[model samples]
Target chain A: MSTWNMITFQDSNSLYSDNLISFHDFIMLFIIMIISLTLFFIVDLMLNKFMNLLLLKNHMIEIIWTLIPMFILMMICYPSLKILYFIDEMFNPYFSIKAIGHQWYWSYEYPEFNNYEINCYMNNYMNKNQFRLLETDNRLIIPFKISLRLLVSSVDVIHSWTIQSLGIKVDAVPGRINQLNLFSIRPGLFFGQCSEICGINHSFMPIMLESTSYFNFINWMNNNNN
Target chain B: MVKYTQLGNATTLETPADLKPKTAPYDPRFPNQNQTRYCYTSYLDFHRCKKRHSEEYEACKYFKKVYTAMCPLAWTTNWDEQIENGNFPGDI
Candidate 1:
């Protein structure tokens, strides 16, 4: 029996994969961090060193400092805008999942699979011996190496479906369906939870996704067929 | 809430007086009764069990017992795995 403190390592074939958008986002963050850190020290040192060298009564230095930040902001915004447009440009999706958020849980439907649907709720016990809230009764399994489209929405209130490994987070708003794309490079289990506060059991709406090879996925789907 | 006795088992809620059926010999194995059922606690706990076991049906009885021991809302589990796999004698 596994002890409470022992962490179960993930299987060898993991699901994580690199994507262009995430790489760009990381680069942008890195640039912003470097600029902020350097500017912070530079500004502090300059303020002390040149306190009396520059004009004391004029406010031009403050204006220059303000415009410099605005210029940096433009540099950050342009790339972010371009990436948003790129992600929004759609193409043919291999498979789609309809996730409907409810009061205390989430329900998912696969229209291709005879409209099969299942409700998922969270189990929050943290005794490593027990499954934590990260696990769900019926995981939304998908095939690896294929782009999967997710249609997210809500039935009662607003919620957000977010998975850190996939780097995808979208709002589940009532009366609106938002779509996102995901493709795992390999086979493994990915866990997520409700990122938005909807109701009393907002913390209970956990999501579990299992990705497998195309052949294994088809076999698993056939086995789970109604 | 009024309690009802069916097959020597006392239920939490009473049966509707107008819909009462004729009394018959009490069977310990299967007790047929009409009563208000509480399902919330049972459903959530069974859901917890499915997550822990990844939908393995052999542990349904053990999970059901755990659910009942915890609270009255232990009725939400569909027990589909056990029904799909079929229950066998001496199976836990």
Candidate 2:
């Protein structure tokens, strides 16, 4: 649910994305705490008449400064590292989708379905309900509440396949297959664009992924076969 | 979970439209962000691919796509000439 003028993060529909938002909030806590402490110290120094002209060598102050930053860093390390590894951990995916980047468009293939490839181009001509430069003629559909492994590659220059709301960004380089792990708890439509500048039409190629139930996905597959 | 069992017996999926075409193996040699090494290495890989397999091998064309994407047309054309003249430095 990324909107044009939205300032904050979009809603989280997956576990990892929710964890990512929690981590962000955790870091923001530290930032606000440090800022408030500094502001208090600055204002007190200016308003109070507590000026000491004596020698400024104190073991207590030195120990406090050294130990405080060390403790803060340690506090920050565990959660950050935990999130880094947690997002990277990939369980056995339920399905696989291969996304290939082209000069101006994207193609998707369901290797589980005998390499069923679909060329998804930008739907420039769209009604008011559709998003501009963010919608494609054919959308990549995955089952809701299922884990998936997405393989990304490029047929031309480097392009990046990323969905910010999902907290996933992967480089699609020619001659290589980069893998991204994804799982969603709820069903929704997510959109992204080729992050890496490939050519003149870099901003044109967009990705629209829809998540539905397993039953509907099967029905869609049956209809697509005809 | 019982519903998911239908996938095994699913019929063939439809072929995508040929909208016109073709990275990545990771190598320590090209660790940097700039992929110039990929440009040249992919060229050599295409030739090496054609050499090991038949020229018309489907997989060999993968390397060709890699090189075409990484290297410019002029660079590939020049390398093609060098390969034909037998003056290319890289061994097949």
Candidate 3:
């Protein structure tokens, strides 16, 4: 967990989140703030001038103001649309995992490798170094730098499978599977919790993912098979 | 409130003792002593047991009971080293 003074996002672990934070910074600091400050100064100067009544009625000013805003919007829209399409693009993922949200806990299923499944429960007791509510009994492990597809659904009620650092949040709704693409740029531990209000133990259901090297993941798969 | 028996017969409301399992002492080794806590703690123990003892994981009676319904084979064997180092999370 990051302190309140931390203005920026947690160092992005995945490409999706990194792009998202950069786009946000560009829009907020570069585009919107600069335009607003420029407009504020111009409007203040116009208000101080004595003969602004005649100039206010000028048709050229109206057209310029409207067109400038439209142009700015076009600039914002281009990247927004590009990112949207980029996120929606489903390249052939190396493997797929199904995350099923129960009343509280999350059950993960690896359909690609013999349909292996694990029910991740919250760790009520914690060690000195472990996070209080963010730790789980089992950590979902994946290989870094690989595109993976996550299919999310719910068994009891609606729960969102969200990881802030990974920039992935998909609703786990009953009877409907929502697919999301995950591509980690590096290997590290990322934590997230169920973002939906499901029941009494909703806050306890946390997600912990361990992104490891490709070689380590292969070794894990081999060792576990026996 | 409506009161009904197991056979759907109308009857006076009665608290069933079987509904609630008593809490027992907490033991890291055999955390599943209480049936109610067992339902919750078994999930943690199954993963912990297999990770600590991969080859003889099936010999763990509690892990075997949980393996029957809760955990899959490949998932259990992956954490053998983590359990040995006391890095696996949970009370057990």
Q: Which candidate is the best by lDDT?
A: 2
For every prediction, compared with the true complex, DockQ reads 0.01, 0.04, 0.01
For each candidate, C-alpha RMSD in Å? Answer: 22.2, 9.7, 20.4
- Considering summed lDDT, which 10 consecutive residues are worst modelled in model 1 chain A? A9-18
Model 3 pairs whose backbones collide:
B51-B79, B51-B80
* TM-scores, chain B, all models: 0.25, 0.63, 0.32
lDDT of 3 by residue, A55-122 (tens): 54778878998998788787767766766666655544566677889888998877555566788999
Span of 10 residues, lowest total lDDT, candidate 2 chain B? B1-10
Query: Which residue runs does candidate 1 get wrong by more than 4 Å?
Result: A1-71, A124-127, B1-92
The interface RMSD for candidate 2 is 12.8
Better of 1 and 2 by DockQ: 2
- Model 1 Cα lDDT, one tens digit per residue, A101-193: 888787876655545677887755756864566777778887765665566777679998876566567888765556665656567877778
The runs of at least 3 residues in candidate 2 whose Cα sits more than 4 Å from the true structure, single-residue gaps closed, are: B1-92
State which docking tier applies to candidate 2.
Answer: incorrect
Where does model 3 exceed 4 Å of error?
A1-4, A30-56, B1-92
Residue pair clashes in candidate 1: B40-B73, B41-B73, B41-B74, B42-B73, B42-B74, B42-B75, B43-B75, B43-B76
Model 2 clash pairs are A155-B22, A173-B23, A174-B23, A175-B23, A175-B24, A176-B23, A176-B24, A177-B24
